[model samples]
Target chain A: DAGVTQSPTHLIKTRGQQVTLRCSPKSGHDTVSWYQQALGQGPQFIFQYYEEEERQRGNFPDRFSGHQFPNYSSELNVNALLLGDSALYLCASSFRQGAVSSYNSPLHFGNGTRLTVT
Target chain B: QQQVKQSPQSLIVQKGGISIINCAYENTAFDYFPWYQQFPGKGPALLIAIRPDVSEKKEGRFTISFNKSAKQFSLHIMDSQPGDSATYFCAAPYFNKFYFGSGTKLNVKP
Candidate 1:
């Protein structure tokens, strides 16, 4: 089966511009999460989407938001981007057996979208 | 505060040698721990994981050792090879969220 897929493998935008990145979870997964990975650093959790609503979010500001559609695809939107927003945007998918039980499902990741803010 | 902390920012090992990476967590509520491997321009892939109930788990050349009392864990790679070179991250899940370490860059030379 195809793994998690993300579109626009790479993107470039200037400061104050809005950018939207897309992701399609693995075939059997129902939950999608987004993370930001900077050069030589581990990924930081951005937020997670389930049941078409945002279930949990990390330390990101209001400028960063996401949406999950009925088909389980997800989109991450960053408004008024800044130079520090340049990083690899990763999308991870997992099967949700239950709200808490699903934590056992190992996360499958996409190749990720490289976003560069100029 | 960073929930999970990993040490040895980078490491170099010869082929057929053993490479070990360590991590510690402050959240006692975290019960599941996982390690991920990533290469340049690629996403981090799950390598191995362990739960607090189990002190150790092994898969192929990778092994995870957990010390519940110390709140520390480690990944050991045996018979390392050049292709094993990659960045490694240790993570823990809490309240449906995951906390990742800064990552360890391992270079196995042949």
Candidate 2:
């Protein structure tokens, strides 16, 4: 089966600009989450979307937002980009509701978009 | 605050040796611990994972040693090869969100 897919494998933006990255969840998955992995650091949760609604969010600012399409695809948009925003943005997907019950159920990941904000 | 903390930002091991990566989590609420492996131009893939109920779990040449009381876990790769060189990440999930460790980059030299 095809795994999660992300758009624009790489992107470059200037300070104070805005950018958007896209993600398509894995087949059979209904939940999508976005994470930002800065250089030398692990990915930090940005937000999660399920059933076309924002279900959960992390410590990110309002500048970071996301959307889930009817097909379970997702988009992550960031405004007023800063140098610190330059990082690898990853998308992960999982089945909803009961999927979380299985402790060993791992979230399938996309190759990720390497966002570089200058 | 990051719930999961991984040790050794980078590691170098001889080919045919064993490689170990460690991680410690503070949240007892975390029930799932997973290890992810990433290549230079690839996304992190699930290499192995373990649950709090299990002390150890092995699959093929990969193994996960979990210490629930210490809230710590580790990944061990037996017969490490140059192909095993990559970044390893430890992660925990709670409150519908996933938190990842700093990541460990392993280099297995022949």
Candidate 3:
């Protein structure tokens, strides 16, 4: 089965410009999460979407937001981007049953979209 | 603040040698610990995981040793190979969220 897929493998934008990144979760998965990975650093959780609604969010600023569709695809929007916003945006998917409070399954991740803010 | 702390930012090992990476967390509520491996131009992939109830879990050459009391966990790779060279990250999943360590770059020399 095809795994999680992210579009626009690489992107470049200027400061204060807005950027949108897209993600399609793996087939048979309903939960999608977004993360930011800086150079030589680990991935930081941005937020998570389940059942087309945002369920949990990280400590990131309000400039970062996301949406999940009925089809399980997701879009991450960054407004008033700063130079520090430059990083690799990764999309991950997992299968959750019922209204579980915790995730026991491992996440399947996509290659990610590399964003560069000039 | 980084929820999960990892040590030895990078490592170099000869082929067929053992490689180990360690991580520690302050939160005691975290129960699920997983390790992910990432290659250049790719995202991290699940390597192995362990729960607090288990002291150690082994999967092939990869093993995860978890210390619930110490809030520490480690990943051990046996007989390392060049193909295993990649960046490894330790993650703790708590309350439906994940906290990842800085990452460990492993370079296995042939």
Residues A62-98, model 3: lDDT tens digits = 9999999999999999999999999999999998755
Judged by lDDT relative to the true structure, which candidate is superior, 2 or 3?
3
RMSD of each: 0.9, 1.3, 1.1
Chain B TM-score list for all models: 0.98, 0.96, 0.98
* DockQ values per model: 0.74, 0.73, 0.74
Superposition-based RMSD of candidate 1 using all C-alpha atoms, in angstroms: 0.9
Comparing to the true complex, what docking class would candidate 3 get?
Answer: medium
Which predicted model would earn the best lDDT? 1
Clashing pairs in 3: none
Stretches > 4 Å off in candidate 2? A102-104
Least accurate 10 contiguous residues by lDDT in model 1 chain B: B91-100
Candidate 1 lDDT over residue span A83-117, tens digit each: 99999999999997556844468889999999999
Q: TM-score, chain A, per candidate?
A: 0.96, 0.94, 0.95
Q: What ranking emerges by TM-score with the best candidate at the front?
A: 1, 3, 2
TM value for model 1: 0.98
Deviation from native of the Cα of residue B11 in model 3, angstroms = 0.3
Computed on C-alpha atoms, the DockQ of candidate 3 is 0.74
